[model samples]
Structures are given as C-alpha cells and as structure tokens.
Target: MGKKLLVLGASGNTGQHLVKQALERDHHVTALVRDPAKIEIKHDKLSVEKCDVFNKEEMRPHLENAEVVLSCLGFPLQRKEPVPYYLQVAQVLSETMHEFGKRRVVFMHSWYTHPESRARCRGFFLKNFFLPYVIGQSLNGMRLSEEYLDSTDHLDYTCIQPAHLLDGPVTDKKFILNETDSCIADAAQEINRADVARYMLDVIDDESSYRKIRAIGVGVDVTDKAILTDDNHSYVPNCPIRISRADVARYMLDVIDDEGSYRKIRAMGIEGDDSYMAVIMEQIDEFKKVIFRN
Candidate 1:
C-alpha cells in the first residue's frame, strides 16, 4: 500500500534522489525542508513544506497522518560542540512523531557508527589528525538519535547505515547486514547515495523493514555459493536483528568484495596499529559465533 511519507532533509545529495524516486512511484510525498525557495522537485504528487527541524512545533504539522518518515538530515562535519544538535533534532522528531501518531521512522547513519563493522576507510592522515572530530560529532549525534529510536518503544523504526557514502554512481550488488557483530566484517565496502535512497524507499514501501536499525554497504554482483545464481541478497551486518536469509546472502556477497575490511580484521587487535583500519574495525566481536556458526 502506498502511504504518505515525509523526508526531513529534502534538499541534499541523497535526499533529492529520494524525493524524485518517491514521486515517480506515485506515493504521497512531502518534502520537508528548512528553505521553501529551494524546492526543486517537479511532480504534482510532491508537496514541499518549509520548517526548521530544530523546532518541535514547527515540524509536527508536517507529520500529519504520515505513515513513514525519512530523515536525510544534512548535518555538517565541523562543529565545536555537536551532541546538542544531534539530540535536539532527534528530540524534535520524537516529539513530532508522538504528536502526529506516526509509527515509523527510517534514518541514516555512517558505517563506523555501528561499533562493529569496518566497511570503509579514512587513510592515515585523515583518521589520526582530522576525521575523528567529525566522526566523533556524528557518533555523538547518532547516539542520541539511536537512543530516541530505542526509547520510543511505540514506533516502528529502522535506522539505515551506509558505508562510506561516496558521490559516485550506484552499483547493484549485495547489502551487508551484521546479525551478531562479535567482530567487524573482513572486507571492504562502499555505497552510492542513489543506492541508499533506493534502499530507503524499498524499506518504506514494505513493512518488513520496520522497527530495525540497519547498516547498509554496497557490494559488487557476485555468486553466492550457498544460493543458486538467480537470486538477489539482502544481508546487512552491523545492523540489529530481524532480517532474512536472502538478505544474509546478499550481505555475505558485499563482504566478499570488501578488501579494505579484510585487512583490518587481521590488524584489529594490534596495539601500535593506527592505520585507520585498526581503529575503524574497532567494534568488539560479540556476535562472531552466531553470525558464522549458522
């Protein structure tokens, strides 16, 4: 069934794709943005609403009778203090979701935020000297957003994670979903914004994706030894439970192509290893047996 959906960040790299895709599908679409003048989508089905996400009251009106909410919030990478901004947006969304009785939410997060997956890279100079501040800020913000999702026990929500979101073109491959993240994946992973938008819409259209916080990474098309050659996979490691086998196989394929990640695993526990890979695969391997045993 097609229901009304709201996108928090309507004017972004990924958000534009999302808006266009939704409109093309004939879904009831509302692009909630901070600036109304910048609305560029051209569809009779698309409705643009201007509101500051920082204000709860300003955002609630847009959530009226909404079935799903997608937030591609354009959070910057440089901030002296950012946890407040993170929590504030989440709080506003939570309040708005509550007031409007919206039961579902789908948001985005980075790959490393999972505390388990190593699906991307930052290089030596970046990780050691620069990206930490931004990554740390994002983590802080995601923590609050994630906490709200967790605490909102009443909403059917899923947090979508993309691995090293690159502005490159989209590639159709496998998705990595970690079931029991005892350790991070042993491969390299990268995803295109278009792919992320496509996946987000897929999740919204189907209730199967509700109530789960997921991390997504794009992989090259590969043959899954477990399944025959004519099926699509859907597995996503570094995600919460409640996934399927088809997804598992798909995720497996992505990991298979992840070279940068594999090297990090061997170097996961080295003391002097600060190759960005070492700290990147920094999540504890609490889910190894469960993930690989079956």
Candidate 2:
C-alpha cells in the first residue's frame, strides 16, 4: 500500500528531488513548503501547504497523521550568526511527530557541527583559518539542535551527517552506508542530493535505520563484488556503533551486513568521484541473495 508523508523543506535542493520522487513512486505526498504556488512539482500525487516552520500552530495541521516526515531544512550559507530557525523547527517537528504518533523522520545534517563522531574530514582551510570562524559564528545552533534531538525521546529519528558537500555532476555511482568510517573516501565527497533522497525513503521504515545516523562518502561503482570490512572500529571507524550487525541486517534484509565493520553496505549504482546514485537498490539485493541464501 502507498503511504502518505509530510515533507518539510520541500523547496530545498534535496527536498525538491525527494518530493518529486515520492510523487513519482505513487506515494501520497504533502509538501510543507514556505510557498505553495512557488513549487514546480506538477504531480497529481503531490500537494503543497504553505507553512512557516517556526510557527508551530501553522505547521501542526500539516504534520498531523503523516506516516513519515523528512526534514531537509537548513540555514543560508552567508549567515555570520547562529541558525536559530533550524533549531526551532527541528524541536517542534520532533514534538509534533511524537504527539501525532508518527515517529519516522530522516534529518539532513552536516559533519561540521557533529563533533561527537570522527567523520570530520578537515579541509585545508576549515582546519586552518575557517575552523574558529565556523565554530564561533555558524556551528553553535546546529550543535544545539543535534543535542535537542539527542535528548528527545519522543520520536524515532535518523540523522544523516554528510561531509564537505562539493557541487559536481552525478557519476551514477553507488553510495555507501555504514556507521563505520571504512566507507569514507575520495574527491571532496558530497553525496548527490538525489541519492540522499533515495536512501532516506528506502530506509524510512527499516527498524535499523530508526534512530540511526549514517556518514556516507562520494562513491564510485564497484562491480567486483568484493566486500570490504573494517574490524578496527564500528559506525564511524574510530567511534563505535551502538548497535550490532544482527540488528542492522535484520532491519533491512536487502543489505549486506558487515559484522566485522558493523556497517551496512550497498551500491547506489553510481561509479566515480561524481555519482548519480541511480542504480537504486539492485546491487544490495543481489548481495543479500548471496549472503542470506539457504
């Protein structure tokens, strides 16, 4: 059966792609965007609602009874101060989802503010001059937002923390997912926004993806079928994943469970530094057959 969803930040770069795909897949989509008429999504399966996320009352009607919610919201890049808007929206959304008994959420986040994990891929500049400015001027509110979510026991949430996002063409390569750092690699890695949408939806109902955070890399297609394992550490390479492999594999039977690394591996059909992440979940399903076959 097709499920219904309330997608926040539908006007955003990633959210736009996600909303389109959801409608294409025949899911009933309610887009809570700041502007209703401004959205170019011309799908019959889609509906748009105008909302200011900070206004909890205004957004409540939109959030009510939605099966799942994906938050693709963020602050502008030029801002030299804290991003209070994001924190307010996230906190309210969390409570709203909890109150409505709709706990599924996939949140977009950056690795900069997530000091808890080691995915901090330091660029030459961020490590040098920009770090102080970033911490002092930009990162505080996001970190607080994360802290709020961390403390919120209300909903089942998943936060996707991405590395330095550089704009480039999609390589149609596969994207990797694991709490482990082993998958991290190459080319000023930024996930194709479309691909991030793909992962968010596919994993939305998977129990393992609930309350889980994944750090991914810009990927290249790997058809060799070689499975790499990083036993050195779990989730983020150095930082251990709180869960075990038995749990991850059980949640999404299609993925290859690398207990050695405690990370989930799947090919997004994207190959190269720039990736389209378009192959869908075909590769992972094939691996599942090999691994889980009796």
Candidate 3:
C-alpha cells in the first residue's frame, strides 16, 4: 500500500517532482502550499492544503493523516528573506510531527552544507569564493536547519544533499551513494532536480534511512552518455556527469530495497579523479549487445 505524505514546498522545482512522482506511484499526497494555484498538476490521489507553515491551526489539519513528512522548503537566492525560514520551518514541522506522532521525515539539503563530511569542494575558485561568497547567505540557513534536524530526538529524519541541480533527461547512470564525507567530489558536480525528488520519495518507506544524512551526485560511470559540450560536442566520456529529471524520477520509483542503506549517510557518485570516456565505451558495448541479440 502507498503511504500518506505531507509535503512542504510542493511548488518548488524539486518539490513538484516529488508530488508528481509520489502520486504517480499511487501514494496519497497532501501538498502544503501557500497558494493552491501554484500546484499546476492535479490528481485523484493528491490533495492540496492551503496554509502557511507559521499558522499552526491551518497546518494541523493537514498533518492529521500523513504518515511521513517531506520538506523541500527554502527561499530563492535572489531574495534574502529574513527570519531564518529554514529554522522556522524546522521548528514548526518538529512540533507538528511530534504532536501527530509521525516519525519519518525527509528534508532537501545541499552538498555544500556538510563540508566536514567526505565531500570536498574541488577547484580554488569554488572553495575560496563561490562556496563562501555566492551562496553564503543561503548556506547559513541550511546549516542551521541541519543542526535542528540532527538535534531533534523525536523524529526519524533524513537530510538529502544533492549537488548542483539542472534541467535534463534522466540517463542510465546509477547514482553513486556514499557517506556524507565521501560522496561529493567537485564543486561543479550537478544532478537533476527530478533525480533528487526521485531519491527522496524512493526512500520514503525505508526504515533504515531514519536519522541519517545522504548526499546524491552524478556518477562518473555515465557522464559521457548524456553530457554535451558547449560546441554541441560530447565531453570526453569519463567526466563527472549531470543527470536527467525524467531518468531520476523513473529510477527512484523503480528502485528495489537494499538493507545496506539503513541508518547511514550514504553518498551517491563515482569515485576517483579522472573519469574519461569510460561511460561512452560502456554504452557502445551495451548498444552492440542489443544489436547482436536482435
């Protein structure tokens, strides 16, 4: 049976995919949004709850039937909204979940938030500048939100960290899962928002992921199969690659269970420094196999 869900930030880029994919998988979803119109998709199994996270009364009723909570809440980079929205949402959700006795919660975070983990910010410009400068303001809230999530004792929470998100189709590359410390390789690593959402919902029923932080990134194995260069050239096949939303959504919903993923902060990506053209060669072999089989 599909689980009931209370999804915050369902209107955002990644949240939309969560909503869509969850419903597609027949999970009952109650999307908590400030405006119902923001949710462009509609389905019989999906319900849109109009409420602000700050309004406890308005939000309480939506929490009544939900078995799990998924939060992708965060403000846009262009607007630095005061009031520490991440922290506030964390507090509210914590209280609400405790009140309803719901335990499992999945949160959207970033690869940059846990620098102390295995993730290393490669490149001098990214480490010395972009990490600290371009996203400094937003990082504060992510850091605080993570602290709150980690400190809370009542909920079984998982903070999902994905590298840069881009719009594209999903590919055949398997997501590289690692501990928070080991998952991220470069500041340039990117994945699709759909892929992130796919992963978040895929683990909704996973009792093992409780109280863990996970980082998801593109794998070095499939980089060449999908990425195109500036001149429409495919980059040398073995580079770290970006993923597609369609592929992510498909994979997450289709993934089978694995006990190794339980209660651990797993990083998903390829290992080593130079991953050139290997993915291309693999794909060619796969194509050849298909042709020969026919």
Q: Report the candidate with higher TM-score, 2 versus 3.
A: 3
Cα lDDT tens digits, model 2, 241-293, are: 12223333443453446363244343222113222222223333433443343
Q: Summarize candidate 3's per-residue lDDT along 1-294 as a digit string, tens digits.
A: 888999999998888988988998889999988889999897999999788987777778887778988998877442233227777788888898799897888998777675454226764445665555455446667778878888989989888888877776545456766555524653237788888888898788787788887777766432323322222343334444434444434434433464544453432223334354554455445444433442
Q: lDDT per residue, candidate 1, 181-294, as tens digits?
A: 311243234578888888888887567677666766654443333321211223222222222334455655656877744643221111122333333344223122222333
TM-score of each: 0.67, 0.66, 0.71
- What lDDT is obtained when candidate 2 is compared to the true structure? 0.62
Candidate 3, 214: how far from true, in Å? 1.3
Q: For this target, which candidate reaches the highest TM-score against the unseen true structure?
A: 3
Q: Give the TM-score of candidate 2.
A: 0.66
Give the 10-residue window scoring lowest on summed lDDT in candidate 2. Answer: 270-279
- Model 3 residue 17 distance off true place after TM-score fit, in angstroms: 0.9
